[model samples]
Target: MHGQTTFLNWNKERIALERIKSLDPIAHGYMDTPYYVAYSGGKDSDVLRILFELSGVKYDLVHNHTTVDAPETVHYVRSIPGVIISKPEITMWDLIVKKRMPPTRIVRYCCTELKERGGQDRFVATGVRWAESVGRKAKRNSLEIISPRMKDKIVLNADNDESRRMFETCSLQGKRVLNPIIDWTDDDVWEFLRYYGCRSNPLYGCGFKRIGCIGCPMAQDHERLRVFGRYPQYRAIYIHAFNRMLAARRADGLPTDWQTEQQVFDWWVHSTRRRREVEDQIRLSEVAI
Candidate 1:
């Protein structure tokens, strides 16, 4: 019985190692080419970096600086060896001033400028998983050829249908994108991290679920509250932007339902109050240090 148990444990370990090796082989084969890893210093990216190291794949570690990233994220990226931080020519503040409003999911101008074009002219690698978001889930696991115009360079046309479509699109003029972890699940990511004893961003330990733009529209209200409380500078910027947006709307004679800068400030203040009230009721609240 003891022998059988030991054999089963060995087999499980072997299977795990093989699964990691498979990903390594795929990445190793792509070495000798210019590729950049779109690292965000999150759990997923941490696992991706480990896999790259284990596979001995040569690639650049690139982090796109939105200028509005969490300080913790910035610190984490800086700690990683050989990471190159790339910032947009025009910042989110500039975009907000020009557009006269904060970004919404329906109008995600941030993604195109801050993210999509951040790693242009290089084969980009991401730890995108289909299970993470509905849109990402639609993406395939292999390399997809995009237009050079879309990314500021023209690359070779490939035989795949996705590549063909990309060749036709003026936006993808000469770029190729690679997604190595497209099939991974949330649980798979945690399991891999546990197996490899990988290090994740400290923000996760502090109750941050997602790390992106400070005031991302996709973030929950609780997240916004946490950010507002934790990062005063970011909160001040958002409040200023909201005020400017309110003024623009009024000047343009647009709809009047928009929240003013003062209102936003009040909401942030009240959110903290509400949190305190809830915590007091439950007796589980710990003050922010």
Candidate 2:
């Protein structure tokens, strides 16, 4: 088993290096203009940054602070050398109030506002690997372009099949994205990290699988519960956001099953799937002032 794993690691390394070589034209062109590394202070990002260094590529590391991230993640990113912190214009609470509902897996406006900010015009490299999720496996590529305008268009006309296709394939000439580790497995990421002796985010030491936004809709129940247990502050913030969302919903005449703060919080974490199972339409609209 050890021998087979070693062979697989070597093969993955070769493929990743080849992908990096293929990205040379884009990387080299952005050399003087400061290419960006979308660092998340996770194991995957750690490996991605180290790979850039190992490959003799120069890039700037940027962490987009979601304002709902675990305190430990913020502390870790701040401690890293040359990490430029990019903060969202609005906080998670502000976003929830604006959207009139908590961000579910399907309606992840928080991702657009926070995690996906600040890489609009320049070339950005990310630690997006196919092994991470089913959606990423299908949608992500080794090289692609992500235009905010295109994404917004898709979000507006989300039901249009052609618009979705266009959004998936849309790219501007010269403004681009590079996901050099798109094909890497989770084991491959850890192997690379171990090989390079890189220090990971402290959350992993506490048995967290990934370091992401605190109470992120994308996280599993166990992950969210762990974070909420360790940081009551986040739970309090979430409860506060839920109260605000419920109030906005009430004012807007929206009908919802979420009656109390606990119910809303529980529904956000546990009932979204059940809710979606019986509905084909969005129950709540964005609250208008």
Candidate 3:
């Protein structure tokens, strides 16, 4: 598996290197700041780090410690030298209690507050691929100007990058990012990683496909259940946090159907409909506020 890039006739590796080298100037103008590479302790981030090194560009591999990441992921991230571990001020458990709600697919406030924080006003690099999800492909771009307001985000595709000078200006107000592997396939990622002899996160060896947060809302029921089974302590932590959240709600005269943390935990892990309803209720409450 290690020397298969040529047997597969893979050229995206070369393309990715070119993309990073080409985008190097965006990292520094008169400033000495380099690209903030978002390293998530996943295979893609590993590939991105390797590509940056191969391209010989200045970059800092930064991992946003969501506090809910699997033990394996944290350990994997630590094993990588020069990776800047950026921990959030608040842990996921505390965040759930503070928000008085669990993170759901409809509104993952946790992601905004934890995983997607940092790299502000700096050029960034991510290993996001269109193959991951349709939502990402639709929202993310090869080159993007981060907006103070997300709705006003600026996307400069390879063809539209002629306005790069203007795109550089937008970075002054917010940030900019380049997705070097935006067009790469899953095969491309695994092939490139193998060629570089990267075994990636240990979770992958244990039959885990995606290794990010332990109980991400984005994960399917079976995947969540599997991770929880492997690390039941995380389930306990979440339930305990939910109990605190319910307590907070009651103290504030907020409405909730969950009488016990067990009830909330079951709904969180099993009931997608209930979670969506809660998200809707949350949105309504915000409107009322």
* Among all candidates shown, the one with the greatest lDDT: 3
Q: Considering TM-score, which of the candidate structures 1 and 2 is the better prediction for this target?
A: 2
- lDDT for model 2 comes to 0.73
What is the alpha-carbon RMSD of candidate 1 to the true structure?
10.0
Can you write out model 3's per-residue Cα lDDT over 1-289, one digit (the tens) per residue?
A: 3664452525777777766776675444633588899999898888898888888788889999999999888888999989999989899999998998999887799998999999887788998889999888788778888768676778777435575555655534567788888998878788788887887999889888887798898888778888899899999999989989999999999999989999988888876656667999999999999
Q: Which ten residues in a row have the lowest lDDT in candidate 2?
A: 152-161
Q: Which residue ranges in model 2 land beyond 4 Å of their true spot?
A: 1-11, 14-18, 25-32, 148-175, 272-289
Query: For each candidate, how many residue pairs have backbone atoms clashing (under 3 Å)?
Result: 13, 0, 0
Q: Which model is ahead, 1 or 3, in terms of TM-score?
A: 3
Per-residue error for 158 in candidate 1, Å, reads 13
> How would you encode candidate 2's per-residue C-alpha lDDT over 1-289 as one tens digit per residue?
1222343376776666655554454454533455588999999888777777766655778999999888888899999888899988999998998899889887888898888878666767788887888987656666665444565221212233464344334544334666777877888887777766666898899888878888888877767777788888889888998898889999999998877988888877765455665563444332331
Please report how far candidate 3 places residue 105 from its true position, in Å: 0.9
Instruction: Rank candidates by TM-score, best first.
Output: 3, 2, 1
Residues 181-262 of candidate 1: C-alpha lDDT, one tens digit per residue? 6666677677667666666788889977777778776566677767777888877887787787678778888776546687
Least lDDT summed over 10 consecutive residues: which range in candidate 3?
1-10
lDDT-superior candidate, 1 or 3: 3
